[model samples]
Target chain A: MGLNIKPLADRVLVEPAAAETTTASGIIIPDTAKEKPQKGTVVAIGTGKKDEPLTVQVGDTVLYGKYSGSELKLEGNDYLIMRESDILAII
Target chain B: MGLNIKPLADRVLVEPAAAETTTASGIIIPDTAKEKPQKGTVVAIGTGKKDEPLTVQVGDTVLYGKYSGSELKLEGNDYLIMRESDILAII
Candidate 1:
């Protein structure tokens, strides 16, 4: 990846997983039933605020709320920037 | 307030304002259109995380996301418990 933007203040940049087009049973899912992927790979992390340290690291898979984060496009790729607290768990 | 619960680690207890039932021009808003109140008064605060201190104090008015925090009822009054970071601003 050639992206060069850095997150600030406990924020993280994530590359969302590709939306699932098929169910586990091999059934094709309609676009209208496709939910936004809630899992993503951490691409960049902030240095964290004073007295706080970030727990997630680059390349770590994380889970977050469907509506969390602000969306931006970089290098023709979509990414989300959100506070660390918005992340629900590290997977 | 006779509530005795103490929030743990950066969490705060807030007393939400009553939902607005009327518009500024005295027009009545339907229940379906009554958005959850995002403003509230701080009733109790936690000691904050290690090396971080709570910025809002008791009696302070605060703003938060519409869907932030967990809801609970105590003493027949509704309250919200959320992390200090969930608070968007102190008013």
Candidate 2:
């Protein structure tokens, strides 16, 4: 958790929720049809802009646009760099 | 514009900025290589969640993720339905 990634200026580092591989009816989801999870846990946060103080916290789970944020790697772990506004709801 | 569409629950309707058809040097850019504009004017907004009253108002020019919102055609004009958080900065 001590990776060097530090979100800056309304950006956030999110650990995306695990993708679902099976449906409620137990039908396995095909790899090509699987979509990236829209939910994630905030691992790091930025100070935010002067006028807009960020509302999301480091431990909060959030919902976001399905394809929002840029993907990157830090310390061998995958993460997404998202603008604070990309997060839809705090869960 | 009196479009019949109304955004619901933290969603905002945005009219994207005009795409740059040419670069600074005036090199004509072709349609095939164009990218969607990241800035837009907020035409409409949702009521927002109980705790998160919306901040951006109609006519506010805002920045958002390039692919963050869903596109829909309303009244012969194109608009994107975006979650409030998908907006990054008010310009």
Candidate 3:
């Protein structure tokens, strides 16, 4: 389902992918894994705020999870819409 | 212990607080806890970038973990010094 969301300048909408369950070698990782993978796809991007120009565009894959951000749901999909500053890197 | 780190514009130096280990009632949480807490304190702040002026300063507590940021270690302590863009909120 499509979402009608117009993020403010420099904000972005991201759809987080489900975390990996098993290792590449078919090793079943126990729940005690310390490193949690952070990955997601870009769904929508803001027009780039006046202060910080937008470095990333819509459809770009990104990675982040450093601070507090607002989480939202559109249709039946989950998404995170936050300021561009909240995004750490474009993968 | 102290660190000599001069964060660039809008970047911040945060000291992550240890995660909670039990519930309020002292209920020990198993390693399979789904909800991981994100919290930290601001030890240093950048001068704020050209686009977005620095909104935070040294000693201002902040929360972040959204994207990729540079990780650094000074002396014997570990720290993550990243752009202000990665910071999510000022707690």
Q: Write the per-residue lDDT of candidate 3 for residues B32-89, one digit (tens) a residue.
A: 5464334566777655667577876767766565333444333444456566767777
Sorted into a CAPRI-style docking class, model 1 comes out as incorrect
Leading candidate by TM-score: 2
For model 2, how does the per-residue alpha-carbon lDDT over B7-71 read when each residue is reduced to its tens digit?
Answer: 55588889876777664545343445555337778988876765898999999988787667765
The order by descending DockQ is: 3, 2, 1
Model 3 chain B TM at 0.66
Each candidate's lDDT (Cα)? 0.72, 0.70, 0.59
Clashes counted in candidate 3 amount to: 15
Residues A24-71, candidate 1: write the lDDT tens digits.
Answer: 545343445545337788998877779799999999988787777765
List model 3 lDDT by residue over A1-91, tens digit each. Answer: 4568888877888887666554232222223223322446788887876656676677776545534358887888888887766654453
Which regions of candidate 3 are displaced past 4 Å? A21-37, B1-91
Q: Tell me the spans in candidate 2 whose CA falls farther than 4 Å from its real position.
A: A21-37, B1-91
Q: Which CAPRI level is candidate 2? A: incorrect
Rank by TM-score (best first): 2, 1, 3
Poorest 10 consecutive residues by lDDT, candidate 2 chain B: B23-32
